[model samples]
Target chain A: MDRNLRAMASAAQERGLALRPHAKTHKCLEIARRQIELGAAGLTVATVSEAEVFADGGFDDLFIAYPIWPSPGRAERLRRLAGQVALRVGIDSVESAEALATAVGPLDVLVEVDSGHHRSGVRPADAAALIEAASKAGHSVRGIFTFPGHSYAPGAPEQAALDEARAMVDAGPHAEVRSGGSTPTARLAGTGPVNEIRPGVYVLNDAQQIELGTCDWADVALTVHATVVSRSGNRAIVDAGSKVLGADRLAWATGFGRLPEFPGARIVAQSEHHATIEFGDEAPPARGDILRVAPNHVCNTVNLADDLIVFSGGEPVDRWRVAARGANT
Target chain B: MDRNLRAMASAAQERGLALRPHAKTHKCLEIARRQIELGAAGLTVATVSEAEVFADGGFDDLFIAYPIWPSPGRAERLRRLAGQVALRVGIDSVESAEALATAVGPLDVLVEVDSGHHRSGVRPADAAALIEAASKAGHSVRGIFTFPGHSYAPGAPEQAALDEARAMVDAGPHAEVRSGGSTPTARLAGTGPVNEIRPGVYVLNDAQQIELGTCDWADVALTVHATVVSRSGNRAIVDAGSKVLGADRLAWATGFGRLPEFPGARIVAQSEHHATIEFGDEAPPARGDILRVAPNHVCNTVNLADDLIVFSGGEPVDRWRVAARGANT
Candidate 1:
């Protein structure tokens, strides 16, 4: 984890870009503090509750990087969080920008420009109205931000990053504090006018990263320690599944997860409590054998774990609580 | 929820089978207590921590339904829990059966038989060997249990139930307390030799259930209250995604989730924090509109939340903590 954090931090630093690592991945205060100590400029979050957790944990700079709807309950929390942190929030529409302006007090806002994911964010051509609305509502507009979420595809990282840059170019004057970066496309961030990069999964490269060729096997820093509970022919059942590993397998991915020890094996399927791994004709791991399995997506996987059993040199170390777990409002 | 509980409870009662609802669905103490009050024999859990949670919540009878690995840490916890509750664990192989017998104190165990899901559990023909191993290790073999997981398909419920029964029959004389049931196949559960049913998702039917014709729109008891955060053309973004709604779209299931408020809409894509619902160029819901979304899988969805906002008569009624939210070992 430290190696991953240092590598990403140095890469962003060399590119002269601000490194605001997304805290939504680990959600651990110790890891967040370590990231900051290793030169992360700030922490990026996805919800007001996550911001509040970091603020309560003594983090002063926090950004909620989602096109958040400022509901009454969330508005009150955002209002309180703005009083404690150097807060930044994102919005993709005029109405939502106005709602957030009325909810959170004196915060910097980023117009969400769509780069290709098509899940949220405004089209580059539609960023003006929301930027104007956020500015008129007594909030400071800090330029545009987009998420290159489409980079999760096997060989689409380069194209997705280029798409992000083209989206920014299409939104000409709104490119000052442009921020964009997914773990799969982090290397291509500085190729555009992006001044800030927010990469969450770089702290814990997962199966998706390895499958995307974004990271090698040695780069994966986190894995689920699963125990083999049953064996039938070549199928080995491990006591870890969607509940522990998270269910974010992209359609093109290999399987449910990846086992570093048994690289030839494929986690064919997952129930709530067990992952079915097929080792083909090879002798399956003996029942009661422990294996380290990497989840498809580390962010959601970390959210599922209550705490992480930190390991060093193949030995157990400290434990870090997932403090912001289930802080999704 | 009350109606769902009563309906499923009465269905099992009329079939002369014991109902031990899987708590992995709701993960709420209030719901588990109400199910017990409605005549559920016991509660079924997926992890040792989950069993501990129920036992701590004053529920005496519990079953860990997965082919559990008896690790040192988990064995210690299981030993502690065996002293407090009527515990039953499932095993599918001689190695795991003997390991579990040596780990926990004298307790009943069920040999897991595969019922066409092929994810976990041994073949029904292989159950005798595991049963004998458990019996020789001083553990009581209660019977055989199989999860009819394939019932989640659009019209496969009846066949899954039949397969469950056939698998039990193949297990010969070890079918004393044959157990099986899934949300979609609950109605067809007792058509064969199953004397006990463990249906979890019937407590809150989801999009998979609705798509499978297991339940209708009105039967869905749980829905994510999401706010429309962004709108563009016909696409509306809601503040709920895999982090809240869970990412469990079966190959034959609906998009991501089901929105009853707009029958024509389908959630096309999901980011970590937003679900993009396309409303067919109908200008979408205005920003800040709250809508209830029935997730593709309710069990994993409930595991993602810290607490549930209960509703009755279209108003907020109570709040319940998801007691076993992250009890994944």
Candidate 2:
């Protein structure tokens, strides 16, 4: 894991925010352990596979922050993990809460409130009804949370945070621990009822972050290493492709990915194993020059690699295994 | 491997077209070995990793169908593999031909001509330039090929194949083996200069094929088995997401994936592991019912799994390891 995690944690402390870094971004045990050592209150996960990884690494506190459906088989796993450490989960609806009531241990449960993203989660007004249902079913309600995913848009973070905080307040005293904000919206949501912040992509900001104006190019901590294989005038081909970087073409994305060093270049197209680049009329990269490509979406990119080559100040340092690279189950 | 692969081969042989099944669709040595036993002429691949898998399994003849740029390291691997088998590769640019000259041994090389896909490959007129470059480098040009990707559109296969055939013929007399056609365009190509066809997805048709009216739902050999985890009056949650089926959203796709058994239900939203579904007043499925989901794209869905469960008449017959599940390199 990157040793600079301590520095990031200290930065979070200065900002007066409790860091519960989302483990779904890296999914490495070493990184999770270090995050805990750096004073992270707990770990946030998107899936059970990620929770399993952190739990096996001996980390205690875990919060799966999705409106997850607790299946019997998976609920058994969660119960086992709950016995080992402090465990919390999220629910968005009365139906999910009712189903989870039978499966989950008497653990801290948060209602996923839809602040802005219009994705999973209930409206703030619906939180009380769901929480009441959970309480009636003998399940403990801990707090309410929302992910301002729409805050990722340029200049939308502040207003999105305000809207989220206001919505959480509208839930009144029932919504005590109002958890809101992602990395992009963290600064805007701090020092409010949304006391806790979960920022997964902050550790390794990506092309999307750059586009969102949340981070500088220098702060990006991860990149896909590719070798130039073919050069045709302004066009060239690199070894990394959709399988490596993922063919996720976001509507406003500048390119498939960005060459961190060669900021002038953009990935024009990608096949499964080869990425095509249009580098204008400049001299194409030599056939063996290894290029560092920063993917547009870091979460999916990390899932593609079996291991990550950790670096500091442009020098290769250590190799961290992506333990749960494709743990879909 | 799929036990019914032999039956699939029999169906193909009845059509008078030899099957050189693309291993890219399902990168498994066990599957490749079975295909060979069932009378597959050779193997087709999109990556060198796939080719290595088949070659290691002792399948001799292999064709890498992508217009890949062979790096020195990859070229060395190709040369080594070439020494062990009859290897043919696709090239679209003069630079790729030069790199191949330096790396590849005496092997058959095909020039990929752009019929209409507009992805990779050169224009029909540019094929001569690439062919001349390859010939000058002592690499014998085998033929010209096109993908006719435009065939995915409704009623466009026949016309796209006609254009593709014209492009191949326009590539001069050196282009002997005019290869074209996928499963959708196989019959529409009309078998002119196209001596061979590579249709890997025919064995397991997907939503894309079904939407294009290429195959019936019964022909789909693969389906994602997901379990319901939560249910309301009409809404339900399942334990499958983008990590399982992939987040490939085609414009013509019918939702993220199709539930063949529960045709009324649709995957409304997906997180990493949780798939939120809206039943909309329909009696919700019981929490344990296994929903068979037909993915929009079978090629990517197979890449996501660690093992493929082969079923004969609905009983689990065998399990084939996805040997090259994350073989991005």
Candidate 3:
């Protein structure tokens, strides 16, 4: 995990961009502190609850990367969190920006520009309106942030980065800190546009990362240690299931998950407690044999886990509690 | 949740079968106690951790529905759990049965039959072999059990129930307790062969249940209360996303989730903290509007949530902690 953190931090440094690795990927305070120690500018989170955790954990700067619907309770917590850290939140609409600006005191708001993943965020051209509204409503406009989520596909990183650059350039005049991210487009995203990147999955590269060619097998830092309980012909049933590996099936994902050890083997299906694997050329694993499975997505999988058995030098060395695992209000 | 519990219990009583609703759906000790109060025969869990949580919480007569891969840690826990209650576990393969028998000590085991899901379990015709193996391993053979998971899709419940009955009948001679389950096929499942059912989702029907015509809007016991943060013409963004609603998009699911208020509006996509909704009506939700979102899969959604705001008579009467939320090992 430290190797992944250093590699991503170094990559951002080489490209002259500040690394603000998304904390939603790991949700562990120890990992977040390690990332900051390795030169992360600030931590990026998805919720106010996550911000609260990292804030309580003593991390100074935090950014809620999603356009939050600040309720009365959330706004109150946001104000409390902001007082403790250099807190920034994403705002995509004029209504939300104005409401947040009035409900919460003194926040650094970023215009969320939709870089093509139509999931959230405002249009790049229309970001100026939200930015202006937020600025007028007593919030500091911090340029823009765009999530190139479309880069998750097999061969779409370059195009997603181009989209991110275009969106960042469009919001460049509004303010200062232009942020763009997505692990797949993290390297390409620093293309003369964004000053900060918030790629989360790069810290614990998964099967999706391997499939996208973003990381090699050795680059994967997190893996679910599973024991084979049953074997029938070429089929082996492992203890790890969707509850452990997570139920994230990308369009191009080969199976439920990937086995780095046996590349030919596919995690064919998963129950809540059992993952059925179709063994490749290698002989079927004996009962009680442990194997590592790289899940389809790291963030959701981390949320499901209680603590991570940190392995070093091929031995279990340390354990880190997933402190912010359930910090999803 | 009370309504769902009553309706399911009543339905099972009418069929003269015991309703052992799977606790994996809610994973709340409070809810499990309520189910027991409502005359539920027992509780069904998916993992050893869940079993441990419930056993500690004082719920007896527990069944680990999945064919668990009993590792050393899990075996030790299972043995401890069994000593406290009338415990039973599913066994599909001979190897797992023998291992579990030797590892966990004397326990009641059910030969799991593949009804129609094909995800886990031995074939109906071959269930006898597994039953025989468990009996030989000093484990008491407790009939058969089948998960009609295939019933989750539209127009599949009736056939899945038929398969369930056939499988139960095939394993009749080897055991005493015949169990069949699934919310979609619960009523259809008590077709004479099964004496008990384990319909978990029926206690908190989700979008998939609504789509499958297994339940209606009024039957939905749980909902994600989300506030609209942004609006773009007919499109509205809600605060609840995969983090709260869960990322469970079935092949037959029409959207990421369903809005009970506007049935026609589709939850087009979801990120970690934002759900993008494209309204089917002319009137769209404004910022600060809270809407109830019925998740795609209630079990996973429940697993993500920390606590549930139990509403009665359109008022928040109780706040139940999801004590067993992350009890997935």
Candidate 4:
């Protein structure tokens, strides 16, 4: 885990870009502290509740990299959180900017642009207009940011990095801190207009990262330990299922998850407490044999567990609490 | 919620079937007590930790309706729990039966037969052999059970019910208490060898149950409250995503979930904290507008939240803790 964190910090340092590792993946205070110690500028979170959790842990600098449309209740909470920490939020629409400004007064904001992911954020060409509107609403418009989510697909990281760089460069001259990059596109984010990169899953790579060629098998730091409960022919049913591994199967995912011990095995189906794995050519493990299974998405898996059992040198070390496990508000 | 619980209890009573409501859905002590008050025979849980949670709540009669393969740690816990409650566990193989019997003394065990769901359980023809092996291992045999999970598909309830009945009958004359039925197949279970039914999602109907024609819209009791954060053209992004409303999307599910307010809208994409809904013909909700969304799977959604806000006559009445939210040992 330390190796993965140090590698990303060194890569960001070499490119003269600020490393603000997204804390949503690990959600552990110890890992976040390690990232900061390795020269991270701040921590990136997905929700206000997550930012508050880190703030409570004595982290002063935090950024919510999400276009938050605060209701009255959330606005009050955000105002309280901003008072405790150096808070920065993302904004993509003028209506949200106005509502935020009216509710929480002046705050640091960044314009989010769509760099081909198309989930959230405005078009790249309209970033300047939103930035101007946000500034007029009594908020500090620092710069622009975009997430290269399209890099998740096979052989798409290079183009996604280029698209992220192009979108930030086109967001006009007022943009000083252009933030972008996911795990797949972090190192590929060239030395251009982008000055900060926020990568969440680099700290603990999962099956998706291994399949995408973003990380090797040795780089993975987390895995679910499951025991084979029942078996028929080549199929082994594990006790760990969607409740532990999570049920976020991307369209391009090979299976629900991957068994690092048996590369030929695929998790064919999963119920609440049972995962049926089909061992194609490998010998199936006997009943009561425990195996390590890597989840397809580490962020969702971490959110499901109350505490993670830390391992070092093939031995149990300690337990780390998922401080922000269900901070979804 | 009371009405839905009562209706299922009444249906099971009229059919002369014992309604052991699966507590994996609600996971709340209050609801489980209510089910017992409404004449439920006992509670069914999916994991050992879940059974431990309910047992700690003073519920003595409990059934772990899963093929549990206990490791040494879990076996020790199960032994302690068995001493406290009238516990009945599901066993599908002679290996698990022998191991369980050796680890945790002689206990009441039920043979699990595959009705149609091939995830776990043995074939009906082989059920007698396993039952004999379990009895030889010094455990008391308590008939058989099968989960009609295949009834989740559209227009599959009738066939799945028949399959369940047939499989239970084929388990031989040693089977006295034949347990079967899911939410979709509960009512369709005819008078046959099956004498008990377990339906979890009937307490809180979800989008899947509504689309499967098993329940009406008014039967749904749980819905996620989210605020519209961003909008563009026909798409509106909400704050509640997979983190709040779990990411369990069945193959036949129409979308991630459904919006009762806007019947024409569909949740197209979801990240950790953002759900992108596409409003087809209905006008998109403005930013900061709160909308209620019904999850595709209520059991998974209930597992995600720490507590649920209860309502009575459209007014917030109380808050109920999800006592077994992460009881996935």
Candidate 1 Cα errors over 4 Å, as ranges: A173-175
Question: Predicted candidate 1: what Cα RMSD to the true structure?
Answer: 1.7
**Which run of 10 residues does model 3 chain B get worst, by summed lDDT?**
B167-176
TM-score of chain B of each: 0.97, 0.91, 0.97, 0.98
User: On residues B236-326, what C-alpha lDDT tens digit does candidate 2 reach at each position?
Assistant: 7677776777665555665677777766677776655656677656786876677888877787778877899888777998888988777
Instruction: Chain A only: list TM-scores of all candidates.
Output: 0.97, 0.94, 0.97, 0.99
User: What RMSD does each model have against the real structure?
Assistant: 1.7, 3.1, 1.8, 1.0
Clashing pairs in 4: none
Question: Tens digits of per-residue lDDT for model 1 on B1-329?
Answer: 88999999999999898999999999999999999999999999999999988999999999999888889998999999889999899888777776777776567898888889987788887788878888998898888898988877766888898888888888844467888888777778764588889999988888888888888899999999998887778888888889999888778765999998786889888877888898885778788899889999898999998888999999998999999998888
TM-score ranking from best candidate downward: 4, 1, 3, 2
Stronger candidate by DockQ (1 vs 4): 4
Winner by lDDT between candidate 2 and candidate 1: 1
Kindly list the per-residue Cα lDDT of model 3 for residues B170-286, writing each as its tens digit.
766435788988888888865479889998888888899999998899998888988887777789888887777877887889998998989999988787778889997667878
In candidate 2, the second chain superimposes onto the true chain B with a TM-score of: 0.91
Q: In candidate 2, which residue pairs clash? A: none
Give the residue spans of candidate 3 off by over 4 A: A280-283
Model 4 C-alpha lDDT per residue in residues A78-185, reported as the tens digit of each score: 999889999999999999899999998888998899999988899989998899899999999888889989899889999999999888888754588899989999
Candidate 1 chain A, poorest ten consecutive residues by summed lDDT: A168-177
The per-residue C-alpha lDDT of model 1 at residue A272 equals: 82
Clashing pairs in 3: none
Question: Which of candidates 1 and 3 is the stronger one according to lDDT?
Answer: 1
Note the DockQ of each predicted structure. Answer: 0.76, 0.37, 0.60, 0.86
